[model samples]
Target: MAGLAVPTWDPQTALLIGAILFEAIVLYVGYGGLERLVGPRLMELLVGGDSGVGQ
Candidate 1:
């Protein structure tokens, strides 16, 4: 009778997971920057004048 086989590490799966993690980090930073750059302008346009919340 054969014993249970152990699972081997998969390089392709590891690389795929690494790439997904990298993309998520990049997207998080990129969106944060975009929000900082455009959030105030968007609020001004939607609210019509200075909200004065930041100041």
Candidate 2:
């Protein structure tokens, strides 16, 4: 197969990959929490309190 060969596990590569994964998870949780905290207020300001606009 012409596919690239996988490299053997190394401490540096493990740390780097772990850091990236940790950052992604942190970002996801942080943004989700912020959205939960402020999303309703933002929607209210943008669309007003009726919430059921179409119905």
Candidate 3:
């Protein structure tokens, strides 16, 4: 039977995980900013006029 073992610290794995987290955060913020920047224009084009909401 195998005994429970303590987790090992792997620098390469840690770096990989950190990079993925960083990329996720950047993508999230970048997409949100893009949406805020272009959402109104996109809606106007699709709706053919002002959305007419939030009056």
Q: Could you estimate the TM-score for every candidate?
A: 0.77, 0.75, 0.79
Best by TM-score: 3
lDDT of 2 at 17: 99
Sequence-dependent TM-score of model 1: 0.77
How does each model score on lDDT?
0.88, 0.88, 0.85
Clashes of each: 0, 0, 0
After superposition, the stretches of candidate 2 with alpha carbons farther than 4 Å from their true spots are 1-7, 52-55
Query: Residue-wise lDDT of candidate 3 within 8-51, one digit each (tens)?
Result: 97999999999999999999999999998898777777886557
Tell how far residue 46 is off in model 3, in angstroms. 1.0
Question: Which residues of candidate 1, in runs, are more than 4 Å off?
Answer: 1-7
Model 3 scores worst on lDDT over the 10 consecutive residues at 46-55
Cα lDDT of candidate 2 equals 0.88
What clash pairs does model 3 have? none
TM-score order, best first, reads: 3, 1, 2
